[model samples]
Target: MTGRPAPAVLPPSLRGWLGLVAAFAASVVAGLGIRYAGEGEPGRVDARIGAAVDGVGPPWRSVALAMDSLGEPVGAVPLVVAAVAGCLLLRRPRAAVFVVAGVGTAVGTATLLKHLVGRTIHGGNLSYPSGHTAFLTALALTVAMLAARRRGRGGLGLGGTAAALLVLAVALVAGAAMGWAQVALGAHYPTDVLGGWCTALAVIPATAWLVDRIADRLVDRMADAGRRGRR
Candidate 1:
């Protein structure tokens, strides 16, 4: 008897899903902890950190200010749009969808959480989560995801893995730099930045999974149509 063909190993999506779930859980837990720590009072940590960060000299101030702008609409929107366009141009419709959904969800969630939690730091306007940090982080992550996906099928082996890691590291550094700017400018507390980062982490993978599911359906449909045509 002829041996059956070996089953093809599917690419791993479970790890991404699991990571998204864990991040969502962590974001919830951290938000609650921050709320509890404030306890209807202004956050002392916010005040202390704000003061320390503000004390730095002009050179650092210039850098912080530049990083802070990255989270603003003027800076962030273009980058996001360009990344999405690039993915579409490359025929990665799924990755493009993930970029829009992931970034949009992260920003929307941050806004919603701010309202729901109704907490503030030093009495300075809905400060539970930093919107600027959320936007910048989401943008950074989207770029990294697109880069990794683009290179994934190129058979670069270990080099591909290293390149992906490097992209992720750079994205993270950019996010952290923006977070520091927010903190230094006294625009948000450290916990607020943490919340934003966690939210992005949660949303990106969830969106990626959704997009992947849609893409799989499309591929299956096309394959079936091709088979029918051949008949």
Candidate 2:
């Protein structure tokens, strides 16, 4: 036996799978409401959250600015490269692909949604579904899913529950951090950040499942072809 580890399967368990499906649906609905309510301006929720950040001083403002930069192209490219490289270093080619594809798709979807929703802030800037928030959340989700799968506890048991919780925790942390930064910087409305977070939640699990399914099918076909040639 090679004794090497198998590639990680996403969702990690039946409950995890169901949870993802529910999250996706809820996120989609929430995003739609945010879009409709805020199109062309901030919504009721955004208004309550306020348009300005007060009492933020040097380090906190600096930190917020830094966090905001992480969503930009210059910042995001390096992060994506590092994640892909790390996955390849661990000999997880599928995970490498998942990181690239998932992050890109999530960010791209947010961009498309911004245009479609036409939600604007601070003028005509399309801002529903904060792209920066989506980018970080997507990256976090990809990493969490990989970590949970690598734990090799993707069964319908306590381990699976822990894995699911880990993914949720990571996603929330990433989403909240970025969302806070965007709102503080007045770069987006609070509802916009929420929309962005939901966008990632809705997109990532499905992307992971698709990547796994396609990669597995390709590997199986290649293995079959090799056997037929040998015979």
Per model, state how many residue pairs clash.
0, 0
TM-score of 2: 0.87
The parts of candidate 1 lying over 4 Å away from their true place are 1-21, 24-48, 55-57, 122-124, 149-168, 222-231
**What's model 2's lDDT at 207?**
83
Reference-based lDDT, each prediction: 0.65, 0.77
* Span of 10 residues, lowest total lDDT, candidate 1: 1-10
lDDT of 1 by residue, 1-231 (tens): 122121111125234443644476466737665564444443677667667775457899888888877777887788888877876776656667777887888899889878777767556478767778878777776666555443343212324445456545755776688788888877777767877776776666666666666666667777777788889
How much is 93 displaced in model 1, in angstroms?
Answer: 2.2
Candidate 2 per-residue C-alpha lDDT over 1-231 given as tens digits, one digit per residue, 9 for 90 to 100: 122234744645724663565487556746565557446766677777754562367888899999988999889999999988888777778788999989998999889888777778766888877899999999998887777754433223336667678777889999999998988888888878888888888888778778877877777777777788889
Error of 1 at 184 (Å): 0.8
Model 2 lDDT-worst window of ten:
149-158
